[model samples]
Target chain A: MHRNPSRPLSPHLTIWKWGPHMLVSILHRVTGVGVGIAGAAALVWWLLAASEGATAYATFLEWATWEWALLIWIPLSWGLIQHTLSGLRHMVMDIGAGYELSTNKTWANITVVASVLLTVLLWLYIFYGRG
Target chain B: MSMEIPLGRVRGLGAAGEGAEHWWQERLTSIAAFLLLVWLAVSLLRLPGLDHRTVASWLADPFAAVPMLLFVGVAFWHLKLGLQVVVEDYVHDDGSKLFWILLINFASILGAAFALFAVLKIAFAGSAE
Candidate 1:
């Protein structure tokens, strides 16, 4: 693959014009990494805390609900939703449908918008509906 | 070295027959993870409280415990597959790329194991006596 030393890299990101598809593609990777690293760590912590007892669980709850932690948790939740939606889109594309230019663009837009909307609704339910 | 044929050159390097299997497995796990996450969100919402005992007991239910364990396994597997791609794309160095791939695999396995153990502990230990 690297036989030609002078050939530019396949994905010359800076040279290619950006579009909705590109945005979604990039977000997919970003969110995947985010969930892989921080999200996984958070899950492990939550599990350990839960198993440890009431005191540990309470401590985790307090810290997780704190304002500062919300910064990370909110974005992580959004990323999780966004990645899931985008994954669904890719799954559809994998099956050889939605290849038309307009349809692809439309799906890309839907993936982003729907992800944000769903995330907001989830948080709303958590805060208000649960209470 | 002897000259290689054009078809052989086109075939290129890396694991040849395994790409399709890896791709299918990744997709399968993604689908499973998506459904499991939805179940988790709904379960969390229905919980009477987020306190230790309530959450632990909820997890202890066989219905919840089994799926949660499956979720951890599938989700971490998906994570490894996704991160492997990212590392391969951005990390141009061969050694660094291999290292990152191994690290991602190990981390995913360890993280998933820890989560599974915690859930099982709660399911059997009865949550802090």
Candidate 2:
């Protein structure tokens, strides 16, 4: 009810010193938006193509298996992993467990590293194990 | 003198009473997405091939189809909530913020519907053509 027109807008990103926490926060948003658009589109396409019949499915496979598609798929997978991990970290914080500065930084770093590792492991499994 | 009535002040006890529900839903959906994604990753990894018949048959299983639908729905809902926060935070103009939020909601619904429809079609019609 009390509107303060002069209230400073939050999270002036430029003014704040960069840290692991900031990186994680920014990437969380970036990957979130990225996956929401590109990832969701890919998912819908895959489902629709699969349901449509063989020809559509074959066409989708062609695109999905293309060398160029890996470029998108890899990053998309990474984004998915990173965003999920970060979301978990956020949930933990929401439960009031990780407010300590050191704990927060540690989790942020862990999220980044683990996402990359998991993404690589996924690709490795797809290429080698599946074959 | 302050013009607000005592009842009005007590009615809304905190900053936007709606925040807790939004916050809780985001967390709940995130947890659901976390589990569903693990299932998805492992399932996709184990798939012998990506051919239409193979993938369709895999999706045709009740275990796969049900969870896939749930994943699509929860993931899109979670996505919409997350993006809404981003838009609310960054987009300065009220008109643009509202537009982006509505667009996000609509797009998420469409995406989820398309996904569920596709899954249901495969589940019921059987991928054979």
Candidate 3:
């Protein structure tokens, strides 16, 4: 891990022009934290409530289904969808393919578009199809 | 060719030799989570309802209980792996990074254990209707 003071520096995010790949990379981390905290906490809360008997379960549904809760729920669902899709892109890169600039950008854009689209579809099913 | 000195080359490791195993486990858990999450979504969609009685009884079934356990376990495992990397990237101080990594591991275990307990309680006891 020794470093020479005069050695050339490696390229970094600040040096490169931003692209979808960068966007997706940053988003992968952001959405990962978002989902890991908010989504998992919510799921844990739901399960705990469910196990706490009928009244507790009803209380959870009341709060969770409230319109205001969409503030947390919408972003959470989007985060989960986005993270899942972007993680797939990471998997592709982990295998060492998709490094070509055009190929990388294409997959990155596709991951973004598909995640948003899938999140909408998921909500639609929840609201309408389930009703 | 790697620019390692002969002895270092023979040893075949970078400064942190533990990385490859971490990388592999992360991917393995990610794959498991992907499959399990999909199965969970589809099964939930097919459920009769999400009411207490309905969902509880569904969970009580072995078919539903087993996969639920696996899904919860793998999701938390993947979360721990990913969270550790995030901590390493941001927390530069050795002490803080160690603290955060330990916190991440503990939180993941607690989350998964809480979830497993809830699922098991329903599987064994909550089916009383």
Best by lDDT: 2
TM-scores, all candidates, are 0.88, 0.87, 0.88
Candidate 1 C-alpha lDDT tens digits along B22-66: 678889999999999999888888888788888888888889899
TM-score of 3: 0.88
lDDT of 3 by residue, B10-129 (tens): 463432334667779989999999999889989988887788888888888899989999988998888888888888777788888889889999998999999999999988884796
- Window of ten residues with lowest summed lDDT in model 2 chain B: B11-20
Candidate structures ordered by lDDT, highest first? 2, 1, 3
TM-score of 1: 0.88
Kindly list the per-residue Cα lDDT of model 2 for residues A67-128, writing each as its tens digit.
99899999999999999899889888878899899999999999999999999998888778
Model 3 Cα lDDT, one tens digit per residue, A11-90: 67467777899899999999998888777888788888888888999999899999999989888888888898999889
What residue runs in model 3 are displaced by over 4 Å at the alpha carbon? A1-14, B1-17
lDDT (tens digit, per residue) of candidate 2 on B31-108? 898899899988886788778888899888899999999999998998888888788778878788779889998998
Worst 10 residues of 3 chain B by lDDT: B9-18
Docking class of 2: medium
Q: Please report, as a value between 0 and 1, the fraction of native contacts recovered by candidate 2.
A: 0.88
* lDDT of every predicted structure (CA atoms): 0.87, 0.88, 0.86
